[model samples]
Target: MEIYIVGGAVRDRLLNLPVKDRDWVVVGATPEQMLAEGYRPVGKDFPVFLHPDTHEEYALARTERKVGKGYHGFTFHTSPEVTLEEDLARRDLTVNAIAEASDGSLIDPYDGQADLKAGMLRHVGEAFVEDPVRILRLARFAARFDFAVAPETMTLMRRMVDEGEADALVAERVWQELAKGLMESKPSRMLLVLRECGALARILPEVDALFGVPQRADYHPEIDCGDHTLRVLDYAASQGQPLTVRFAALGHDLGKARTPRDILPRHIGHEIRGIEPLSELCRRLRVPSDCRDLAHITLVHHTKVHQAFELRPATVLKLFKECDALRRPDRFRLMLDACLADARGRLHFEEAPYPQKAYLESLLAAAAQVDAGAVAAACDDKSSIPAAIDAARTDAIVNAREYWQRDN
Candidate 1:
């Protein structure tokens, strides 16, 4: 068997990036031969094995044919006759189609090196349209590598979307790709690329509706709600925030998309309006509870967070209770981070000071000092326990706010 290093490991090394995983393609090999050589079978659908020594993935060079619709509707053909070139041809992007021989010599029959040098994301062949997941992968690559998608590949992607391939995607698959893209360094690219190909509207219509919608220029100097959202998402990614924080930043302003045009850009009750769409988006995607809860909290209460300095201590304490700050301080902190990102997401405000984050965090900390157990014990009656605890926490919040104001 002639084994060659292929896919992302080869592509990343060519671009001077740190290679995280290595996949090997075994040319002129059968599953019987692989088993005879001590490799362990691992692939469920096709011939894939784990190297006995390195434990890296090794798949027999295979070609795929489209047999039906969506991502799972593919038939993979593997045999000793399948050439490495044929296997490479089935890849999604030209830049990912290159392979490396055992002698370290490069193989670039599809000119993946050329496209890599040009920083282009081009489809390997017309077969790219067969898999709907390629569009999500391409968009994710755009976010990760900061590459420009080739016009022809984009055309193919648009065709896939228009042909209802996007609709074939299951909820978990979309979330899987979206969550990965959110963790990338430039997550906004993923959404923008999807938006360009019309898949964003197909999968995430709430986010898509935000693109052309206008925001008040005075507050959001970027003017477009979509632009501002991207800025917020990029900011969160830049700060190395976790997926929950980044997603909260993303969905924080969905209500603005529902703003009545009759009121122009005011969006007087947009925070309240945001509840339904964001909830529906989370439910439809089957999003994880951590991400869903934080996104919702960020959407409903981010405005309250921004106005923290203006509100009374009772309102501030109410914010802490509503966010469950005492019980889940970590999530509460993530909520603050998303709100902080939102505050800095406007034009000419990328580095603007958002004292609101620190301010709210301090208030939460102050309220958390309340000894709930002791307060519960001191309560004369069972139902009065919650009220007593709230009263104590409010007093603590008042003192903490006074100290913060005095110190600042």
Candidate 2:
């Protein structure tokens, strides 16, 4: 049996990216052959096996056809007769179509290496429309690689969205891709691409409504709400932060649209309103309950950091207690990063001649020290630690030490 390593592992290796996971494609290998060779069958939809020793995934070379709608409507075809080039040609993006033989030689039937070097994302062949998910996948890939989508592919994506092919996508799959993109190094770019192509409205009509919604120039001065959100995403991604942080950054201002505008630039309780929409979004997208809960908490707490900055110790502890009671640190940090990203996106801060970055750094450093459980307990006690909250600052060193201790 001849085996070849394929897909993301090979693509990432060529790009000098860290290979997070590896998948192999075995050609001319039957399930019987795999069993004979001590490989275990594991896939229900296709011929996939687990290596006996390394426990890595090994799948037989396969092809797919669209039998219906949505991401899951495809039927896979696998046989010893399918050529590597034919399999690669069916991929969604050129950059992901590269393969490596067992000897570590590269296979580039569609010039994936050239496109990778060019920082471009292109569709492998005309069969791109067979699956609607490619539109989101292309956008998500662009976020990951920070690469530009080829003009032709962009045109195809636009056509697909315009033709209602995007509507065939389920909310869960769309959310899956969106969450991954927001977790990437350039989420805003992906969002803008989606916005430009009209897929944003299909999944997040609430966010789409923020497009061109006026924000007062005195404070915002960054074009509009949509532009401001994009800035936050760009800033968050630039920091190389974690997934939740980046997600919070992209979603921090999502409440602004629901905020009352009777007064100029007014968004009183917008954060509160934001929680429902964000939660509904997560539900619609079929996100895991834990992640959805975090996203909801992130939305609710977006305004807390700024509000807590000047609180009395009792009040601060009470606030901390409330968040701690929820006991979701991942969600809290996600909100904090989102808030920080929004603050950094202000026109004044973006062009500042001052050390705004340093100030933010100091704030994050100080805020890190407050324990979520301690704050939750304090808030639950109803005994205001207003003084402590007012004086509280995150002690980065202490927090880091604590983190290390927990791991140990």
Candidate 3:
């Protein structure tokens, strides 16, 4: 059996990127041959094995034919006689179709190297239209590599959307790709590409609806709610925030999309209105509780967070309670980061100072320092203990706000 390093390892090596995982394609190898060689068979639908020594994935050289619909409707054929060129030809992208031989020679049957050098994402062949997931994958790769999709490849993707291939994608798979894309260095590009091909409306209608929605020009000079969302997501990434924070940034403005036309640029209660769409999006995608909770908190209270200095101490304390900030300080920090990203994402406001973050931090710290047990001990009646603790926390918040004002 002859084996060659293929897919991401070869592609990343050509681009001078750090290769994180290496996949091998085995030619002239059958399942029996792999089993005799101590390789562990693991693939459910195809012949994929784990190397006995390295334990890395080694899939048999195979060709796929579309037999049905969606991403799962492919029939795979693996045999000792399946040529490496044929295997590469079935790949989704030209840049990922290159293989590396044992002697370190490059195989360029599809000219993957040329496309890689030109910073292009092109499909291997017309068979790319068979799988709907390829559309999401291409968009994700665009976000990750910041590579431009070739016009023909984009045309094929648009055709796939038009043919309702994108609609066949299940919510779990769509969210899987979207979560990966959101973590990329330039996640906005993924959404932009999906929007270009009309897949965003099919996969994430809540987010897609924001594109033509308007916001006040004075506060959001970006004007478009969707553009503001993308910018906020990018800003969150720039701040090195985690996935939960980034997800919150993306969903923060979903309510604006449902704003009344008469309201036009002013979405007075959009923050509260956003909760429904955000919740719907999360529920439909089966999003994890951590991400869903933070996104919901940000959606419901982000404006209150931005307007912190104007709020009463009791109101600020209530904000902390509403977000469960005292119990989950780390998540509270993430909320603050997302809010700062939103404030800075607007036009001509990229570098604007976010004193709200420091102000809230101080308020949280002060409120957390209130000795609840001491307040309980000082209370005359058992029923008054809860009220006493709230009063002390509110008082602490008032003092902290004054300190923040003095320090600034």
Q: Please provide, for model 1 over 1-408, each residue's C-alpha lDDT reduced to its tens digit, 9 standing for 90 to 100.
A: 799999999999988989999999999999999999999999999989999999999999999999999889999999999999999999999899999998999999999999988989999999999989889999999999999999998998999999999999988899999999999999999999999999999989999999888878899989999999999999999999999999999999999999988996777898989999999999999999999999998999999999989999888878887888888999989999999899999999999999988888888888888889999998789999988988999999889989999999
lDDT of 2 by residue, 129-229 (tens): 88888888888888888899889988888888888889898877787788788887778778877887888888677778778767777768885888888
What TM-score does each of the candidates earn? Answer: 0.98, 0.79, 0.98
lDDT of each: 0.93, 0.73, 0.92
Q: List the candidate 3 regions with Cα displacement exceeding 4 Å.
A: none
Query: After superposition on all CA atoms, what RMSD does each candidate show versus the true structure?
Result: 1.0, 6.9, 1.0
lDDT of 3 by residue, 21-130 (tens): 99999999999999999999999999999989989999999999999998799999999999999999999999999999999999989899999999899999999999
Off by over 4 Å in 1: none
Measured with C-alpha atoms, the lDDT of residue 31 in candidate 2 is 84
